[model samples]
Target: MSKKNRKFLATTVTAAAVAAVLAPSVSADELKFTDVSDTYADAVNFLVGNGITKGVEDTKFGTHQNITRVDAAVLVARALGFDENGKYKDAGFTDVPDRAKWAVNALVQNNVVDGLSTTKFGSYDNLTRGQTAKLLANAAKLPVNDGVTKTKFTDVNENFAKYVDALVREGVTKGKEETKFGANDAVKRGELALFLDRAKEHFGFFDLFVMHTNDTHAKADMGPKRATAVKELRSEHKNNLLVDAGDVFSGTLYFNEFQGAADLQMMNYMGYDAMTFGNHEFDLGSSEEGHKALASFVKNAKFPMLSANLDFSKDELFIGLQNNRYTSDYSNGIYDGIVVDVNGEEVGIFGLTTEETPTISSTGEVQFANYVEKAKEAVAAFEARGVDKIIALTHLGYNDSLNFDNDLELAKKVEGIDIIVGGHTHSELKDPVVSNEFDAPTIIVQAGTQSKYLGTLNAVFNEDGVVTSFGGELVKVGDFEADAKAEEILAPYKKKVDELMNQSTGVSTEVALDGGRDSNNEGNSSVRHNETNLGNLITDGMLATAKTINDKTTIAMQNGGGIRASIDEGDITVGEVMTVLPFGNALAIMELKGSEIKAALEHSVSADLRDDKTGLKESGAFLHVSGLKFEYDSSKPAGERVTKVEVSEGDKFVALDDAKTYFVATNTFTAAGGDGYDMFGKAYADGRVSEPGNVDYQMFIDYLNVLDKVAPAVEGRIVDVNPAAAKTVAE
Candidate 1:
């Protein structure tokens, strides 16, 4: 065969025996076109990549363009990669143009198709959908229905019935309407691609391996162990994707000292394929520098980050980094979704942060769209690009905040997602939890937080891109020995952290800082449901810090959940401070009406579940206040429990005016409505919240320095009016 004859289509195609690593498009070229609507993306990509034309232009498919009879023969003959049995010097038709003679003759000699007539090839006549289907059926040698002459489609005639049924049997065309085949309509360039692509046969099961992690936080010290696991997993599977779901941000002294720089370096060393934003990724957004650390992390990343529901357009720092398209040809940066090529098969991955980020963390101007809406859009986008096997890399938590959003809810709501790698709730799913029980399975997996485990999913997708079998497990990072290079990369960062961990902040204390919790649910603190000296000290520091930011700032409150651990009655070390306020919460000041304050104070004491021992309700939301006092009836209901509230002036306390507006300071968590503080949530939504970025621990340390001796006592600022509740506390 001459070079042009061989160019009829592509070289010999082989059936692929892939384990998650499927065959590539013939000639290994990336399909480049966008005008073709997503409705035809899969079929267009299939034939254009492997069978049909290489697009009308370099970047255009011109799907709406017309194709003549001779033109269709030329394409189908080439696309079929027909084996020529006839050495036709001419097609023996007078009207057949020399340019189309060889292709028409090739199809005729093979008995695959013929001209409209022997005298004329109808070179300029357009091909209809039925005619195209018959030609494709013959080219693919689809079995003719034996003696059967009817089709399920209403408009399909007896002549085209068998051909249309054959196409449908192969999952090719589903007709224009379910019951109607638009058999006589002109076959567009796109339809031609789809029919031909879907008509081709595929056999055998394909295997895929996905390695994922979520909520790893800044435990860079575990990098060596995780690196070992990652290397081992990738080495075992030729086709694999290594991804982190999110929260590679705050947790330890590493994040506190180096921000995200250290974690990014470790992630790069481990060769992360992709990552997504966690609510904590936006923790630095309220800082004075305004998401600078997070932005820098994205820019320096070796892999792309994804978030379909996140809109970084309003945040100038992330403007150019975000490519608002789902595509198979991806690059390093951020995108709504990406189709990664793994061992020849394409896998689509998108991301979603919890919509509560603005309330749960300091998310500044970066915005979040609805997850379900963006998720559907992502699935459609990937499908258009001919990619199945979609993975939703999410930080929405596992079955968390059900009233809002979570992985379980996401799995139930969205349809096409094959797997969900999630975090936020830090659930350790030992086995794969399957959703869409009645439909296609969506396997959900989450590794426990702080780099403790590496989640691995080995799944097999059948010909039609359906998961036939899957197994998943969380591989403990501690089980593996450290990788030499990982340790080498980690040494300097660990050394820096070690140097700071034990260092005294020069804040002397005569009494221990009581970051204490009552016995009920051991970590549940009295500082939560009532005032503690530690809460007072922290609140005093926050109030002081707020005053520095704004002189009018008077009241400061700290949530008990934000306080993690206690300090001893000795010299204060950097480590203890971090342990207590490890989340790196900044100061967020919001203006609230006195009515709203009373409502919030009500929520603070409204815990209905009382501790068996203390007879006090266990609540993480208990407020530790400075420059404020409140009395609440614990026996009363949630929204109406606060009896009286007062604000402190310089020398005297004044009853809180219900309509007066006041500036109150707290950690970013509460300011953003972290712990069911609806008033603050409303305040944040109303644009009354301002994050001054005062590091809470730093403020506490500064206050400790000013006090010369740290012996803070609870001063009865918050009192429960219930007599029995008071007696239980005394007991």
Candidate 2:
């Protein structure tokens, strides 16, 4: 039978149920209702409320009687205000006899039912769940959010795709979370109510300040927690916005495997209002194909991409859907800036990225113009166009010291920008740092790299759209409830990464770890300290590895900042090591004059001496070095603290002279004099140094795997100097 006829027939059979509503004066127990008491009760109440159904008599709701197709159609038509107004011929249903002709005509005219065959209507079939949802959704004139692309849902296969898609998108139905939508199941009255409520919420509009995220690096779930804080603020003020700063792309292997497809999906499911690009968005290798892949990854996104800087005019990456582009720079095309409505106020947003694209982005060709200049122009245009409230979605670094050309400088230089939501040098701003250089306060914020932190800024704008008063907080990921939808999206990808990392490598006695110096922030000891066992293990491991490569190589030296994290006591794996040493830098073998080595030693020693955080002075050298021993005088000044230096030739201490050269193994960064090692870095520039592969972490791991149990201990590698007591005060 045709679908129309089946619907018509089902309508006829259910017409009695639809029309009968128990009278308020009568008790439900006395009301004559159907066998499905729960369904009937709800249906009766709803129908009666909506004026679709009425009781058979004062107290009789005749729900049990099988409803004919014609009766169902007439009742439904009456509810829809189609009584006699909607005209229809005597639609011939094979089973519907002439006696019920008016009902059939009414059903057919309302488009709620049709004959089973060209000349017959099956008017006695019961309505199923799938059919019920579709009918209700259509009756309400709801809009379906069927994505422009398809996903992998078993139940949403070809045959019922359209109806299922519409019902699900219109919020009339839901799959059994983590399971397929059972389309064939019988419809329940309770489920129907939920569908209706959801549909209403979907169509009902409310002013919203939406915050969103993308490419959080491996920040492993920080977005959810920060979003919660923002949500709380949103609830209180009823006007707020939160969003992600990007690059959730490549630094971590978790992002490498799924190409961040799962991450982006989670962001979309979390109801993010918008997103901008990060350099890592081009990590998969930016070509037409790579950009296309990224585009596809975000294709399910309901919100649009806002990249005012990228020019995709000639790039195949943006060929077809130019509408996806949104800013003032491009007018004939879709502009990148969006005016988000907040309680009758329009707030404009534009996105910008760092100019370091040429060096950092691995994917498709990226062209970045002067962000500060472009931003100033954009803001001026927004103001001229009468858009007072403005926000810049920036992927600029927060610590300009780390990223020489940072966006914070941009914020300082630009006058009209209200808020600079920044990323890149992932800084965890516990609170918003207000920039007063601009006429109005320019707030700068960033979630630390990896999904570990989320940055939120709250602003109260004046009539001119400049922020008069504002504050922000950085939220830790552990603080909030993980959005269920985000969890669902991440499950598979997380499972895959877990499977890969769970393979055991070695175990530690206990957690021997410390997250080293964070370049993104100002502090050093949090990640870079002499006390961290991680630093000890890494330097020792490098020394051990160098011994294998060069028997003459003594004392492996590793920068404190290079020691990523301590190996916590537990099942260790290759993945953890990779995470600790993601740079893949290589070891460099250098011959340095004794005096120069001593000077290099003085730099770190001094930095550690005056450093209030870690008491590294009592711990010899802050820089983990093997094959060398020295002591320091805690009472002496920094550069003069190292009093004595000794070199060991396998258990023997030897005298060292300033003119003599010692062969040492350390990272190229050090050899090039990074971290105040000007002497070493300058050595390489003078062609007195040699270096190896860019992947240094591999060498450390190889050294570790070979040892049955590597035990690294602190020796008196550095000696302290004290002036032989003054002839003195005693005399």
lDDT of 1 by residue, 1-731 (tens): 00111111121112231211212222212235656776666455445433446677766777788777777787776565543353664557777787778778887777877667777877887888888878888888887785657787887788888888888886678888988889888887877766765554422335678899887778888889989999988997776889999989876678878888888888898888899988878877778998989889999998999999888888888878889888776778789988888767888999998886776578887878999898888888877777767899998876555545788778767778878899876667887666633245567888877788999887656455655445568899999999999889888989999999899988766777777777633643466677877888999999988887678889999999899877888888988887888766667788899988888887787788474433356688988899999887776666777888889988899999989999999976687678999889788656576654456787787788888578888788988877776776676
Q: Candidate 1 overall Cα lDDT vs. reference?
A: 0.76
RMSD of each: 17.0, 21.3
Q: Which 10 residues in a row give candidate 1 its minimum summed lDDT?
A: 1-10
TM-scores of all candidate predictions against the true structure: 0.53, 0.49
Off by over 4 Å in 2: 1-215, 220-233, 286-293, 313-315, 321-335, 401-404, 504-572, 575-600, 606-621, 625-638, 642-731
lDDT of each: 0.76, 0.55
Which window of 10 residues has the lowest lDDT sum in candidate 2?
A: 1-10
Model 1: residues with Cα > 4 Å off, grouped in runs:
1-203, 402-404, 504-510, 514-532, 535-571, 578-709, 714-731
What clash pairs does model 1 have?
Answer: 8-78, 20-207, 528-622
| Candidate 2, number of clashes | 63
- TM-score top scorer: 1
